[model samples]
Target: MAEFLLEALSEEIPARMQKRAAEEFSQIFTSELEKVGLAHEPANCFVTPRRIALNIDGLPLQQSTVVEERRGPRVDAPAAALDGFMRSNNISRDQIEERETKKGRFYFVKIETKGKLTKDVLPAIIETSLKKFAWPKSMRWGSNSFRWVRPLHSILAVFEAEVLHGELDLGHDKLVFTNMTRGHRCCGAEKISVDNFAGYQDQLRKARVIIDRNERKRLIQEEAKKLADAKKLRLREDEALLEEVAGLVEWPNILMGSIDEEFMEVPSEALISAMRSHQKYFSLETLDGSLAPYFITVSNMPSDSTRDATIVVGNAKVLRARLSDARFFWDQDLKSKLDERVLALSKINFFDKLGSLGDKSERLQKLVPTICEFIGLDNVNGAVKAARLAKADLSTMMVSEFPELQGVMGGYYASADGELPEVCRAISGHYAPLGPTDACPSEPLTITISIADKIDTLVGFFAINEKPTGSKDPFALRRAALGIIRTILENKLRIPLKQLISKSLDEYPHLTDSNELLDFINERLKVYLRASGVQPDLIAANFEAGKEDDLYRLIMRVKALEELLASDDGANL
Candidate 1:
């Protein structure tokens, strides 16, 4: 047994693509090795901005030899058939033996196959894997017809104590595999040689590169928190941001920078969104849970007093510029009321076939009143008001710049415009519970508007025959359906989904009956219930009982069924 290591060094890969690419590399290599009768103990994959590395432990030095039996024609068959079988098996008639079976006697040849060295098999595997590598988006560089996420640089393949040298034909050029690789592009660009996984990782670390992405993320989090603690601030946790930052650097140097006092007056969400989305900086919060005047950034180089100071200053300046733009949008948007922005939505297309967002908003306004009535809520006026302005922020300058703040900015604008409190809350909460685990709105007005908004989208899309199929939900209708079901079940609302969907379809003149839309929502409900650990049969039984539209009651019945099955009498059934 021996260790094997392979590294493909290239230009900086996109942060989103690094993890998936590393996974592909590991899966393809290990599965191919196993298919060739070369079993390995386990494989570890590591990725950084500039490299994807795989290390396999307990790999056999060579494949095991095996004996195979080749069945031939019947012993009494024609001479032509016998000759063809013998020729195909590369054995003469003298080498064949007669075998008796239940059907008839047959001729068989026993052949012994010699095993090949692991190094010899790996070249073909590596070449085929590279040629078949799939990237979400690939580009051809120079004159090469070979497509990669970026330009091909170098490949390092080592087995035991020897370099497995081979050439990868990239159509226009050939990349020669060797036992050499370079480290951090800035801090260490010199060639480094290694014969094993342990030596490769050690040398890379000494050259100012951390090839392990998880290690980089841990260091960033721990060191950033330490810096925040020293300044009497807390790091606002963002795992997505942390992963992205880790993928953007080989060597992470956590540096704390301060936001200007003037820009801190903007909404914390806006400021945080600006820094995190545009600048890739992590926000800090004070002891009182308010936005702190500081943010943390990770640099891709080793830390030095002078260099760190310059990096911090440069980052702070960039953040200030981004926040200044955010502030300007904030001040300008406040001068106009959210209701005034409603007219501007006509210019923004929601979807090519679904009409404008302004049209959707109008439909929502009309649908909320009926939704409130069905749910037995008396706040129809407030629900209708919220529906009218929920998407008004889509036209706001702040939301135009930061599209993630759509509903959030509308709430701010509504509050500033002196709208009713329930109205403002409803607008803000309409898009809540976006995912399975996100919070669901419980207030009457918010629930009414939220369900109304989602129903309009579902019915409109289904009416146009644009429903999600398989794994391709271009409009995220599945998420919208899931959100609706979660809100209804969590809030214990007895509103009939089918009835509301029918009313929603009525509001759209061209839309037909919403039976198909109702079925779609039910499918999403089953998925949601199954994911929540409910048995599939329980959900099926509940749906079969004709309580699918009333999600709360259906879930209650499911719980009862689960309990009944847990008891003695029902267990027998």
Candidate 2:
């Protein structure tokens, strides 16, 4: 048994690419080893912006020898066939063995393959991996003609004390592999040579680099939490964003940066979104649970600077500038009525084949009321009005510049337009549950409009033959369909999906054939049901989009049926 460490050190890999690349390296290498009759107990992969590392445990010292049996020509076969079999097996007639069988005795060839040393196999595996490794995006750098996620920095392929030197000619003008690695750009103790994994990790830590992303994340969270506690503030935990920020840097430094007093007047949601999206910063809240006047930013440098005050001031200046832009857009958008711009959406293309957003918005107005009644909404008028004005925000400059804030801006504009409170809320609420855990709108009016808007998008897109197909959902129909399923089941609404989808598309004469569209939704439902722990086949057996009017009831039945299907009685059926 022996331990192996394989590291592919490269220039800064994109944070989004690091995790995937690490997983691929482990999966591909494991499968390749198995293919060559070499097996290890378990292999672990770790990744950061600088390198991908794999640690294999209990790897065999050498591949095991194998005996192979090859069938040859029958005992009484032609001379030519016998000669060919002898040549194929590398044996003459004297070496061949005759075996008795039901169809008379047959000639057979037995061969044994000698296993190669672990040292010899490692190099070939490493070279093959380098040549065949897959990446979503790669590029060639300098004149070397070597392509990678970034320019190749070093190849630290080591097994115990010996580094595996394969046939790969990967070296840049200044970088080459010899078990040497540089530490953190700001804090570590310069270049050092590592004989093993421990030496490698210790040397990197001294050089200011945290080679493990998970450790860097822990340090970040601990330091950030400490800062928040000192100020008696609560850290707003954005775990997804935190993981992303963790991958963005090798050394994490946490600091609390103040916001401009004037800029604090900006809505907290807008301010937080701007900070998180643009600066990769986390927002802080006061002890009383209100958005605090300060936020936290993680810097990729040591926190030993005497100019920390100056750094916060400079960061505050940048935050003020960004927040001012949002405030200006918000103020300007509300100075005039949004209704005046509803007519302008006709100029903006929603889809070339399906017509304009204005056309879709118009259809939504008619469909919303029917959906509201189906969802048992008491405020049908409010929901309908909200749906009508939802896309109206698309014509605003704020939404034009920041397209991600479409629903958000609609809520703001609706409030500014002096619409009823429920109507204003519904405007933004319709897009809720964007993700699995994102909140579903509890208000009936909001739920109705949300269902109508999503259904319209799914149906309209399907009508135009743009349905999602296996691993290719450019239109995000799957998400739209899942949103419908979750909203109906969560809200306990009784709207029949097929009826609603058909009625939504009924206005478009070109969508007369709704069969495929119906099937698309049904397929999407099966996916959703299966994901939510329902047996797919059992769900299919009991519930379908075609016959079911009440989606919520159908989901309940599907779940119950799936439970039975997993039981002994249903398994027999």
lDDT digits (tens) for residues 394-431 of candidate 2: 99877776777887778877777788888888887788
Please estimate how well model 2 matches the true structure, expressed as its whole-model Cα lDDT.
0.78
List, residue by residue over 1-573, the lDDT tens digit for candidate 1: 998888888888999899989998789888888889998887899999989899888888888998999888997899999999978878876899999988799998999888999889888888877877798998998888888888879989888868886878888889888999999898799999999888899999999999889999999999999999999899999999998999999999999989899987788999999998999999999999999999999999899999999999999888888999999999999988899999998999988767899999999999988887878888777787899999999988998899888888899899999999889989988898787778999998988888888888888888888888889999888989998888888878888877787788888886665547777888888888888899888888888866467888778888999999999989898
Top-TM-score candidate index: 1
Give the Å error, residue 123, model 1: 1.0
User: Per-prediction TM-score, please?
Assistant: 0.97, 0.91
Clashing pairs in 2: 184-207, 188-207, 188-208, 189-207, 496-549
Q: Distance from true position, residue 292, model 2, in Å?
A: 1.4
Candidate 2 segments exceeding 4 Å error: 77-95, 170-177, 307-310, 535-538, 544-546, 556-573
lDDT of each: 0.88, 0.78
- Report the lDDT of model 2 for residue 54: 80
What global local distance difference test value does model 1 have? 0.88
